[model samples]
Target chain A: MPDSSMPAARASTLIVVPAYNEAATLGDVIRALRADWPWVVVIDDGSTDRTAAIGEAAGAEVVSHTVNRGQGAALQTGFRYGLDRGARQLVTFDADGQHSSADLERLLEPVVSGRVDVALGSRFLEVKSDIPVLRKMLLKSAVVFTRVTSGLRITDTHNGLRALSRAAVEQLDLRADRMAHASEILDQIASHRMRYIEVPVHVRYTRHSRAKGQNTLDAFRVLIDYLLARVFR
Target chain B: MNAFQILGISLSSCFAILVVLGVVRRRLRPLPGAAWAALWIAAAIAIAEPDLTVVVARALGIQRGADLIFYLAILGMFIGFFVMYVRMRHLDEGLTAVVRRLAIVEARHRIEETARGEHEASERSPTD
Candidate 1:
């Protein structure tokens, strides 16, 4: 196991989990994360389910949205909260229980060590993740698209499992407010020229989590976002 | 000019003149008015020289000039609709953020109030 002690520069690490209708698994996810990293902030993105209540009961500082904004906006809110609390490092985690708390150490190593400004968790790197074949193809296409557009050379572009140093988080201005924000983050990483590294992490693809994954139709919106970003810039 | 050509030219001239007047009167932004004026002029040219569309269409690998114009007009309309849809979505997101901030603040305030009320109740019961 990687060292459990927090790094010097990243003493107060805050885990930001943006949840939207994941009440079924959110409590367990928060509990697991809080076990290792105590500072947990859950942005309940307007879920009709008991997501916010469950998160609050699980001992997490819950920030809730009254209306359903996308995951991107929720994550930004969490980040802002983290920043206000003076977090040295900020982590973006999924609330669907696919991301392992065990991988948190690995994901944070580079960022915490000050070797890289950002640490991205790549399931395809070394771990044997059991993602579906079609999903794998879609992810590969996304990587190629990111490379072509954002010029970010990384194995994964859309993984929610990642760590950001305080500086990196502060510099990123995320505006997509939707699924496209994943690509927008990569675009920001490239434009900001922040040193980034990909670490191997395992992602368990449960049936529910798979169902919650982005649909193929959303690819068109991502493409439009990419084109719009280029044009507007 | 043929009857169709004459009609197209007249309508385009009227549109161009109106756009100019609107821009001069500050009723419309110059950039958009200029764009509209240019579009009307282009439409007039295409209508007058019907063969030009055919040539441009062939160059673009399309069969007929009329079909090409039809496709372009449809595409432009779709693009305009999409842009408006995106703008509305953006406004909706901003509203969501504001609502979310209010929700969070209210929740925190309610929690604090409940805790304070419980503390006061316990203190008074002990005194009584």
Candidate 2:
């Protein structure tokens, strides 16, 4: 039975964090995301380390897989889990502890207000994310690629923090298995003609995060992957 | 005895030799495409000369040459479909997860951006 008294369906949010091998960072990130929103989910994708155990201890809804399927697969699990738990809006956060959970409130405001179907956290749109110079250049290229492909005017394309509404989540099919899937999601969103916005997102430049992000060689590889996803898909 | 029969024999022999070479080179990965191709060629030759199928099937102790080829070929196709289905599923699972995480990363980044600006401000100017 549909309730006629309900207002235009006020949206609730869940944070989905994908933990690869960041056992050391999982506890802090989960703790922070949960303090603001109780609905914090962590998907531990085939970590040879203690990634799953740490997330579980951090009071997150943990999903673990035995085989390593890549970041894209881990994120898919978190999305389905969050949606099943009655999350009206789903936000994707990194498990590397580079992102601040405090900004989630600002990120959620646009979506909850019904201003956009999707809201992305942009590291380059505002002040610098303290990203390395080479990584910064690579991200700029990724932004251009996404702008051209997705037809979105956002400044940062690869920024990890993004929010999606329930309808948007149901419509999206995030099936790319590797890094390029990041680019693919924008393509899907644009193709579906969903409204989206980019908000200033802050990323901490931890030594470890820098190591995990772009170097000269890795930047080249990311560029190759971004271009190839369109050509191959 | 017929021109068609001679042509059938020649094509079958050529194809079989090529498939055998593929198998020997280790390029053959038990694909059903090759199996189905083999079956069609064998059937074509058998049609050209029915006695040829009987001779081959009997040599392998099969009831009928058509029976033997049909069963083997059917099994091959089932295996191929199974492999293809599994590969498709693997791709689906991988893609779904990445896109979902992307949304999380998007949120977290926004949260972080505002948080850091606040942090910098707090340090620079004390609030009342």
Write model 1 residue lDDT over A1-233, tens digit each, in one string. Answer: 01247454434888899999999999999999878777788898989999999998997878888788888788888777777667888999999999999998888888888999999999989899998898888899999988898888888888999999999999987776778788888888899999999999999999889889877887778778667655553
Error of 1 at B59 (Å): 21
- Per-prediction TM-score to the true structure, in the order listed: 0.73, 0.65
Model 1's CAPRI class is acceptable
Worst 10 residues of 2 chain A by lDDT: A1-10
The candidate that achieves the highest TM-score relative to the unseen native structure: 1
lDDT of 1 at B110: 66
Mark the 10 consecutive residues where model 1 chain B has the least summed lDDT. B99-108
Listed in order, the DockQ scores are 0.35, 0.10
lDDT tens string, model 1, B45-119? 898898999999999999999999999999989989998977886677568668656856765686688779999
Q: Which stretches in model 2 have alpha-carbon errors above 4 Å?
A: A1-11, A220-233, B1-128
